[model samples]
Target: MVEEKSDRKKTNTIIFDASKKEPFNINEGYKILHRRLKNSWKVGANRDAIRQEILRTCDVFVLAGPRMKLQDSEIEALKEFVSGGGRLLVMLGDGGEKRFQTNVNTVLEEYGIMVNSDAVVRNVYHKYFHPKEAFINNGVLNRALLECAGKRVDSAQDKRNSQGLSLVYPYGATLNVSKSSVALLGTGTACFPLQRPICALNQRQNSGRIVVLGSCHMLSDLYIDKEENNKIQDIIFQLLTREDIKLNQIDAQDPDITDYTTVPDIGYLADRPFGCLEESEELPSDYMKLFELNLFKLDNVTLPAVLESYEELEIKHEPLGLIRPHFESPFPPLTPAVFPPQFRALKDPGLELFDLDEEFSSQMERLAQLTNKCTDEDLEYFILEAGEILGVFQNSSVKRQATAVLDHIFTQVCEFKKLNQD
Candidate 1:
């Protein structure tokens, strides 16, 4: 029972190093990874400096996207821990050590694994939108990885069939794996750095192992469950913790990977151009003879021909003489104010032309004038003019006729008589 408990303690604990201010931790960016690892492993973080004592109880020590540089002592402690049969997993992002400002390569260089200071991108747009979110469909390098991920490995087909597993490698860099290390994953043909290594593993004879991944975000909460990534994570943890899974010897020695070739920055080169120098024309022995002195000279060579053509064209070629110009005016010429200023006669005032007597006359005077102006033949006309003068037509709504005016006046006279009677 004591041996059983010892074995459980040795194989169950996984420590995430946070001493270097790593971007992913147990409670932060790696929450999903932490929960997945919680079922079988005791996952925790070491906030203090990494030392031999802190890593003694850890079965797997993870350094996830360390943004700060690791001290020499801490690096030495990690090396010692791995050499003592403990497994180590180191993950970094694109732009590698220079962008992260970390010296993690100082330790990884000894194990024949170094993260490149470049990024992996997709040449074409596929499952993910961003170019940096490189979706590699055929990136598995070793057949053992297929077996660990429970994928069928066909030995009858070529080695390319081993790339059946797919994963999304987001914001990742590439890796340089030496002969001492085994490359496990590549960027595939679709990615920019075609078929280059992105993940590597190095195992010593002492049963100590180390795994380096290009991107730490592959197992973060945002992308942990994306396209067989969880299975890849399981394969990685299984390789580190369990001893039953073994890498294929032939694939480990010579991985299906291409050389890490760099592309020149065309934009940078285009900004600072160096054009080819054009050759000049060969000069004569006497440079003074080359100058055409008559090029700008005002010569009279064409003057004689021009004068001769004037006679043939029946035109005069004598010196031009000025002639009197006749200026016609669009309007008649203005005469002086000699005719003693004939001013326009004063305009009549806007006042109405009316007779004072007619305007000031009362209704009875107007009726008397109308009666005197009319005879028996003009009686109706006189009545209408009188009604207009007395304003009877304005007081009633009837037509301006002699009978209507008479009727209105008679109606008023009856109403006045009735009032008197009452």
Candidate 2:
């Protein structure tokens, strides 16, 4: 019973690596994956350097979207771990190693799997909004994957059918797989880099296994539940942990994938254009042949023909004269009026409109006139006008009201009274 427990512990333990500052972890971006994994496996994170001691305790080690560079020792340790019946799962995002600033390819390339530095994008808009969320409708490269996903795999027709398993590969790149590895999934015809590998598996006889995925998001909380992705995840884990599921040797040998072809950047080529030189025609032995005499010479070759035509028609052959054209006037010509010219009188001087007495009046005289014009009913109006004439309202802080005007006047009177008493 104790041996069975130890075997169970060894079989179900999965260690997610975080020593390289990976983006996903148990308590963070991988919550859904953690929850799903907790039901059957013992999941945890490794925050220290990857060593054989730690790898010996777990059956599978997952490196999810690591953004930091791996040490040489760590790479060697992982290689040794995988060679000794251990499973290794490495997941990367779009832009691959250069974008992530890591040297994970040092380890992946050893197994004939290298994630390309290009992104996988959909050519048309589909259920997902982002173009990087490539929806591959027929990307199953190996029939073994379909069989493991509980899909019916017909040996004849369903190998490259449109009704195969689909996946939403978000923010992912493509993989360049070689003969040493088996391409399991690919970016189908609907995506850019058409029919290229996105997931690859490498297993040796009586040795460890390694699986490389182009997209780390496929098993994250955001996309793990998406179309057939959960099934794909199950298939990946099954391939790694279980030995009953075997890859089809025929499909593994020749995957339905196209070669990685690069297209020239049109914008770059347009910016730097090269001119082509053409071979000039051989010059003739005579230099006179280079210049054609009929190109620009003034000639009167038709003059004689014109004179014969005039004599044949019995017409006068004289120099043509210009005839004066008489244009009818639309209206009678205008003549100056037979009367003395009249000019507009200058406008009357504005001085007559202004009263000199009022214009040059002192403030006291204006106040006196305002007093005469107002009565008891205009007491508030009279004070306001008197204050304006005395410039009491010049200070903006003083309110323009009857009480304020009266207060100003009283304050000035009090100051004058105080001066007299002193």
Candidate 3:
């Protein structure tokens, strides 16, 4: 007898990467987006190093704003994941390597996608924030998304209209992808006349789909709800739900990183070791020394030690704990002195630096000869030379004298041209 086959669909799973020092915190700011997907799919964080076995189970692998370079094994696992029909989404921000300091291009370039190092800016009307916060109104929606957008309002189709909707382009970089890749968004040429592409998608016939977004800020908590950023959430959901994309189950092990185990001691937006004010050179040296000492003390304290020390200090559970030092001192502090004493204002001595009567007489004689007997060509040459003279003198007093001479020469040239026209 033939056994009856079950017809249940497999449960989709998505994992947001946190092993690469990504700036956006999914648990905190991105909780809204996370909560939306958790209802239907198994959404979780990949805190440990990326493993091939993990990717095999995950239907969607999202690497957003990675601040460090991916290990060779990680990159291979991602590439293999997509090749095995798993959807992959890569989101990068502006300042490319200079900002995230990650070697993202090494992985993307192999897939015919290149992320530029420059920031995409909208010099025209932007959100109330900085100019880098570009606003994108023109986006070429995909066919599936177009159908969703064309649906009537309040209808079932309207719920997914976010697919073809335009999005707010925050501080993002531009992309260079292959011609086969579908361009989803093109930035205006107002700020950058090139009109570069910012978002693209490449769907293999039956393999995994690759989606690239230039800016990670669109998904960020602070700006995700602003403007049309909700479209990002919609698109991400669609990518995660697509059933055609397949992944394999594997009994693989995580990679061993004996040579790549060390991480740099640089600070990120999350684990800032020092306060913003402590970075300024104007701050007192003693205060900085004390601040450094406090940071050192705090670094060695474990979670339990921190809680125990808090009880010893009898500090409330307020935002700023009383155990932290104010870093202010009452002792006699060194007086602040001007940094560059050489650039101080120059004094006007009683004696004149140059004999104005003699200099003026010489300039007047030269001008008189050039304006009267000199041809129009000579006057034009003098005007050009006079502009060069003004450029050479940088001091205000010297520049003023040079300007007066330049103006005199320019006037003569203008008057000479007028006479010639007459």
Off by over 4 Å in 3: 1-11, 141-144, 149-164, 191-194, 243-422
For residues 1-422, write the lDDT of model 1, one tens digit per residue: 01111222475799998888788899998998899899999998999988988888789999999988888899899888877788999999999999999999999999899999999999998989999999999898888888888877776755566567899999999999999999999998899899999999988653678999999999998888999999989999998888777788989988889888788999999999998989999989998888898797788889989888998999887888999999888998788877677788998789978998889988889788888888999988987897788678777597888999899878989999999999
- The residue-level lDDT of candidate 3 at 92 comes to 89
Q: Candidate 2: misplaced stretches above 4 Å?
A: 1-11, 155-157, 160-162, 274-422
For candidate 1, the TM-score is: 0.66
lDDT over C-alpha atoms for residue 99 of model 1: 93
Model 1 off-target regions past 4 Å?
1-11, 274-279, 284-422
What CA root-mean-square deviation does each model show from the true structure? Answer: 19.2, 13.3, 29.6
Of the candidates shown, which would achieve the greatest TM-score relative to the real structure?
Answer: 1
Q: Which pairs of residues clash in candidate 2, taking residues 3 or more apart in a chain or in different chains?
A: none
Ranking by TM-score: 1, 2, 3
How far residue 50's Cα lies from its native spot in candidate 3, in Å, is 1.0
User: Is 1 or 3 the stronger prediction by TM-score?
Assistant: 1
Q: Rate the local accuracy (lDDT) of all candidates.
A: 0.88, 0.88, 0.66
How does each model score on TM-score?
0.66, 0.64, 0.51
